[model samples]
Target chain A: MSTALLHTGTHENQTSLAKKKLLPYWLLAPGIIWLTIFFLVPIYQLISTSTQTQGYGIGTYVQTYRFANFMDAITSSKAQLFRSFEYAFLATCFALIISYPLAYAVAFKSGRWKNTLLVLIVAPFFCSFLLRTVAWEQILGEQGFVIKTLRFLHIMGAQGHLTATPFAVVAGLTYNFLPFMTLPLYASLERIDIRMMEASGDLYANALTTFRRVTVPLSMPGVVAGTLLTFIPAAGDYINAELLGNPGTKMIGNVIEARYLAIVDYPGAAALSLILMVTILILVMAYVKRAGTDELV
Target chain B: MVDASSSAHGDLILKNLTKTFGEFVAVDDLDLVIPEGSFFALLGPSGCGKTTTLRMVAGLEEPTSGTIFIGKSEITYEKPYKRPVNTVFQNYALFPHLSIYENIAFGLRRRGVKDVDDQVQKALDLVELTHLASRKPNQLSGGQQQRIALARAIVNRPALLLLDEPLGALDLKLRRAMQIELKWIQTEVGITFVHVTHDQEEAMTMADTIAVMNEGKIEQMGSPADLYDNPQTSFVANFLGQSNLIKGSIVDSSGESAVVDVFGTKIGLPVLRNHAHDSSVLVGIRPEKIRIAPAGTQMNGNILEGGVISDASYIGVSTQYQVEMPWGQELMVFEQNDDGTPPLSKGDSVVLSWSPIFTFGLAGDQDVNAGSEAHPESE
Candidate 1:
């Protein structure tokens, strides 16, 4: 009887322990289901479409398993893909340069005005994203105040127009994604204890040395987050190119959009989209590994 | 290796140094002279301007007026990096990204030291953290990080080393261990150390000279023993340890001693030691200085009769008694638990007595309860 009771007790303990171990997985089920339905399924469908051959009807494609479509799509539009990365890289660098000082000011120097400054950093996000991009076109127009001032200062020639140039496109991309760069940098910089700076000074490091050695390294996590946030969306963005850029500066995103919506080439668009997605994943993984912030991942 | 030139560094002097934040005075016209190669402490409660003073000396906060001289050089307006002073901040403030080795070498590298391997290794050895040299600060415990902060500053062989509550974050047991370790390091290096802390025991244990500050002013400055045994202010008497101050009026005064009356009892006070400016004074005696005896015992000076032990706590080393006097004032007395005598219990009849030498007289014109602010029990 005692042996039977012990057996039953052991069985109950094992079941309860199993429940405790599975509790976390049960909690994670909702997120996993959401990702599978919303993200994974669409990606799978896109991948399958990327391998499909062209069909006879407009906007209709058959799954013939033609993997050569990816190679053909990449070879045909390699310039646009390269240009897209170039613009995104330039925009990310420019955003970093501009946002770091702004973030630093908001984090350390604003003092009593910190809340006001942070709100202003995020103020652009409250407006419609497309509306803000359209506003940039007008701002960079030849007749606008900004161009007029540049003309007066001889920075731009009388015949020069910024409306449909690569400069205007990159400028618009930079302006549109600035908040993404700034907020993460601000969060990371703000988390740093001010005593660390004082300790640096106390340890006989000058202002510049301290900033380079202590402040910059400590804020790298934020820099990484901000750069990724800005670059990913900016690389995949075609709206700025459509509105502010000419045919010579067209990016891969614009090509993909044209193939899918304007020309009704589903297989070609899906192939380009898949290529862009894989290339970005590889680059992001490499960058994250080089940055040595697996904890952030 | 010791640098002979660094050892020859002179004293740190502050003359009429004041720091004001708009309408509020953080550090009032403070003047202090810290002798060379001495361990000095600025002890006070929070918001007492001890930190403000240390910051002014470190060149972190610019002083509103006056001059600061390290040795003979007037570093009043000098930049922090240019000054040959270093600090161990309250939170250790070790670089989160840098390894223990790099953190120790940071100051030396910044000052253009090309070869720092030996110095960094020496510092790691000094802190007994050589094995953890490759680990970042976050990987170390609080005590280890604190020692790293110290090693980082001292590796530069700065003329003056400032410590702003360096052990404030450690647990009690770890803090006690670090205190001895820090004191040993300071002596081994023989650098002038200025430590700021609100902990009395931490200060008393580490510093050769202690300055008790309150409200942006120094109440008393002396050796720990001098400050404790001969506190001139009521604030010092109660703040340092615990004091039983009794109100009294001086009846007769001689060269060195004065006769005073408390309730119905008479006591002799050392006039030379007292800084009283009025006829009325408060006689101060430490709790441990007062002896507890059975009621009706023949006692000499400063004896209170007809007192009952209102409360008694046997705290291992000593038995504390709160004796309620005839005049309704409670006087605390500590009797050492020696000779295995049976401890005193509450409500027992007792007499409180002490020698005249232990009695300090403060100006009675001041508040009798000036330093009687409720202090949190020390850990």
Candidate 2:
């Protein structure tokens, strides 16, 4: 009788746990289905359209396997490829440097002002990205306050112009991706126990030592997530380079857009898009391996 | 590994220490001198400033005013690391990212100590965690994690070690085991161990001296036996252990004895108070000191006639009885169950008696109310 009772109790506990596990999936099913339809299906269609042959066997693959196209794009447009990566890398580094302290202040120092600071950080999202980027162009234009200030400070020479420079493009990218970096870093830093720092200090580590040993290691998940979010999007961004950069500052995104829309080269555009996607996939996989993906989320 | 500069019998002296969080004073004008090489416990209920005092000493908190000294050195402005102190947090606060070996080596590494591997191995051996040195805190049991926390703190060999309810998270059996283990570890290390706990039994069993705190003040401070036997205040009497506080007026008083009428029964107490003619006082007696006999039995010394109102609970080696006296006073009596079981039953008439020397008198005031109010809430 005791054994039977124990079995029933165990069965009841297992049923409860199973039901709890099912509830989350039940709630998540609709979102997964929506993504599958809108995002996954379209991506699958893009891959199939890039590889499928029309009327002949493997004709599209054969035509596009002009793997030489990838080489040609890189060799002929090496400037644009390097410029895009350089601008994206610089922009990501700038965003990380500025956002880490901002997120730290919001997560640890602001205390009761945390919610208000977070709201302020996210307030830029209320404006359209194009409008915000356009606003920066006006601010850095010849007649703008920055140019006037620099001229007043005797820093701008006769040839000094903020518009149409790689600096402008990188700045624009950093501005566009600042929120992405700040929000994830803010989340991770906020979840860190304040006592951990106190414990470090109590163990004879100064502030800098504690930050290097404890704070940076613990916040790596956020750093990886923020880097991926900013770098991937910035690499493919065309608006900032188009609006704020010179003709010499054209990025890979501009080339892909020109191939698809201006030049009407659908195969080339798809191939370039696939390459960008693969690069991002490789980066994400590496990040997931280093810092557990669960921690990232 | 202890800091040799402050190692001459590292005694801690706090002078007029006070801390306030906004309008609430957590610790008020606290002055305590803890000698070196002694296990001292700060005993109090939650929010009584015992934890705040411990934190101030650990340098986790800054006092609103006053100074602290460790072995003739004024360390009031010193950071926790600069001071010769380490803390074992209540939750054991072991670094989750590091293994036990790395956790123990953290302080030594920060201090740039040589031979870290040998020191880590020694600490692991001291805590009996040599086999589990590679294990993470999450992978270990609660008791094992507690030992690792102790190992982490003592490996640094600071002049003082502070523990804030270190065994509070363990199960009863584990807590009991760790209590003895911690006491033995403190003896083996021979360091100044300032432990904070709300468990009176834990304090009594482990501490060389116990300071009972209440409402941001040290209500009483002495050895566990001193606090238990001759509690100066009613708060000390009730806070340290279970006591029946009988309210009465002193009708007769002499040098070291007083006759008090409690609920129309004249009970002779062995404690004398100045100006006790018409002064109201409280008589405190531990339940174990009171003996229970079957009715119609002759007894000696402050005998009370009562009937057993509750069933006798056989708590391992002792039986506790709740006897209801004629004056509606419910008295608890603990009888040793040496032979086997209790000889009394529920609703059986019984005689409850205690010796005069077993009872002590405390001044009747708000302190008595404070003791009574704080005692039941802790349990």
Q: Which candidate is the best by TM-score?
A: 1
lDDT by residue for model 1 (B1-379), tens: 2222343369999999888999988778888999999999999888789999999888899999989998888888887877888899988888888888988988887776756899899988998989999987888888888888899998898889999988889999998998899899999999999999988889999999999988888999999999999988888888788988888889889657898888867888998877789788888899888888888878776787899999999899999889999989898888999968799799889888888898899888776666557342443
Quote each prediction's TM-score. 0.94, 0.90
lDDT accuracy of residue A180 in candidate 1: 97
In model 1, which runs have C-alpha deviations exceeding 4 angstroms? A1-29, A152-155, A294-297, B1-8, B374-379
**How far off is model 2, as Cα RMSD?**
4.7
DockQ of all models, two decimals each: 0.56, 0.39
- The Cα error of candidate 2 at residue A57, in Å, is 21
**Ten-residue segment with the worst summed lDDT in candidate 2 chain B?**
B270-279
Model no. 2, DockQ: 0.39
Q: What tens-digit string does per-residue lDDT give for candidate 2 at B125-208?
A: 988889998877788988898899899889888888999999899988888888898899999989999999888888988999
